[model samples]
Target: MAPARKEKPIHSLFAGATAGAIEAFITYPTEFVKTRSQFGGKKEGPITIIRDTLRTKGVAGLYSGCMALVVGNSLKAGVRFVTYDSLKHKLADKEGKVTPARSLIAGLGAGMMEAIFAVTPSETIKTKLIDDSKRPNPQYRGLIHGTASIVRREGISGIYRGLFPVMMRQGANSAVRFTTYATLKQFVQGTMRPGQQLPTAVTFGIGGIAGLVTVYTTMPLDVIKTRMQSLEARSQYRNSFHCAYRIFTEEGILRFWTGTTPRLARLVMSGGIVFTIYEAMIKAIGGREDEQ
Candidate 1:
């Protein structure tokens, strides 16, 4: 009967952070496979990568750089949701409705911020550690060691190896994902009765669908970003554009979607898990603000 109070940025931050950590922990092996496939130097399918990894390095190798991702992704998600929510609030009309285009802009802004502050460094470290783990003798011991080594050798830029591509990828990724999710969730919520809340299953499905769309739409950028951040790829490509050019010219066009299988798998689950947990966390942490 009462009006729903405004959404808090702090709640968004905490919910998004918790959601990201849980999603990363659960879906990381798929991520490992996707990154290895995208590395492309020794290109292999999901099955082959898993088999070889298990054989050579055993189970733990599948999670070689997980800690880096967990930490980075948690921070990234927190920043992303907070930024997106804040921007959406700013862009909304008198009644707080944001158009699809505005939603896209907000998500793009969020993605760019997270990419600059969190994703590039995190991804660079994770990519390097994975590369090192596959070597004859791995150089970096763990997340701390790998990061310290990178800082020591290349200074700050080392950790931001693929900033441009990462920026583009994350921006496009979040734009597509958030816009799609917001539109779909809004539509779904519209169908509900007054005083009703969205079902968790519906939220999960909507988020998964959004992620699926984003994967196909942004696959090439994802592949390029991974390659650019690679430890072995230092001398290979001059820049992100050059890396993309070579992958297209030398490896053929389809090469850009190298890790689609695992990435697709991961993102579906990840998107669903992230939004579901995020919603749950919001409800738990900030109390329900259900629509009436």
Candidate 2:
């Protein structure tokens, strides 16, 4: 295919939304398992997690808060890419080349914006649904009821229980992700002829690699965020720092990486799928970026 035409900011947003929905639907089961595993101390591996979840809640259990997650992710993705692109435009040099620092800054900003606006509240409900699934009797039937229940019990602030950790996790996540992605994408394009489109497989591979790097670098924060959010009350760890301290002292430092396997699998697949779909959708929508 020929190089795509230039794109506007709105194109990035739309492409991100489309990509988010597609990736979330496909990888949600892994996400559910990852969250469960993050609680740590259960000898159950990913396979057992899947088996138990299936046995108890059925296949639908694997998708408990899917719609809420999907919608939230859709909005978050849009905001993330849009903010990144806008920041990139401002930060790029005269030749329009973005340094690693600038790219990371843009990604951090994008992640923070998305986390504050969409991720915190969305994940609050999503985690509640997932946590509830293990209960003998699930309290919230679905997304709507779950949201209402949280508000009723905890008030508006309830939905933002893990806001600080979420911001930190997401900030680090996108910063590493976009920086790696941009660097790899540049290398990939450098190897090809001018105006030649990257193959779909290559795009996915690069995205997968970026996702892996992002996950490992930010795994500790991610674990803390999950622990903070998963609890219905503040009884367990107190705050993010205390959570980290307790997990370190009691569970050992390794507990910070409790969910690495499922998370790695989910994120790698999600990154590849999301990036591939995002690029394809952007191209289809007549939104294009200059060959870097």
Candidate 3:
């Protein structure tokens, strides 16, 4: 008889990339509204923000930096899942099973990798889009023009303006997210009947909860990253730390969570979708050898 086929690394990467892309597209409008509400500083609620933006900029405006989002998210998810799987396997071999601590380490590594390779430029464009929309006289029209303007005005370095804060936020965010998911999955599985596999619904629910926790916990750093990256187009602050301190002092503690409502909602939906798809793909590929 022929031997069973092994799961390819690219399969997981592609799965993650595809899932991330789909989720991003589905939630792009929400994302646009969220970004505007969070960073635009327009004195209005989320619904009003969306209505006004669409009224002025139209549907295309809602997807202003979608290309950047797609490319960035695809790479981020691909690298994150691939690295996370690789690290988990290596750690499992050495330590014999996944633990929260080990998962945290894996998440940290994955987060750092994504932050360095993907988050900076992607977030920079996203921030510019949000900030520019609030501008009295906007510079670039959309994603393409915004990208070109950044390159022409400030060069490549400008694209990675908030590298440190991005790394810090994402690294901690990943650490918390994956570690919580891993630990919680184990707990949920342990509580189930013998030989029972974790249900898809349960996994999605848990992942959503984990994502909300991570996003909220690390939201302060995210605010700093957004402000820092947005500075590429304008002359507001000097660096990430300075920007953070200024916001904290000037805007108050609540300022760090300016648009947290949309973020929480986005995380709940996106996190559920991404993790559900990821687990489904892993199962479809017959990756799990033994279920608890």
Question: Model 1, range 114-195, lDDT digits (tens) per residue?
Answer: 9999999999999999888888889999999999999999999999999999999999999999999999988886788875
- Report the Cα lDDT for candidate 1: 0.90
lDDT of 2 by residue, 135-171 (tens): 8988888999999998998899889989999999999
Task: Name the top lDDT candidate.
Answer: 1
Model 3, span 53-106: residue lDDT tens:
888878877787777887888888888888887787667633245878889999
Task: Compute the lDDT of residue 56 as modeled in candidate 1.
Answer: 94
TM-score of 1: 0.96
TM-score of each: 0.96, 0.94, 0.88
The 0-to-1 C-alpha lDDT of every candidate, in the order given, reads 0.90, 0.86, 0.78
Point out the higher-scoring one by TM-score: 2 or 3: 2
Each prediction's total of clashing residue pairs, residues at least 3 apart in sequence or on different chains, is: 0, 0, 0
Candidate 1 differs from the real structure by a C-alpha RMSD in angstroms, to one decimal, of: 2.0
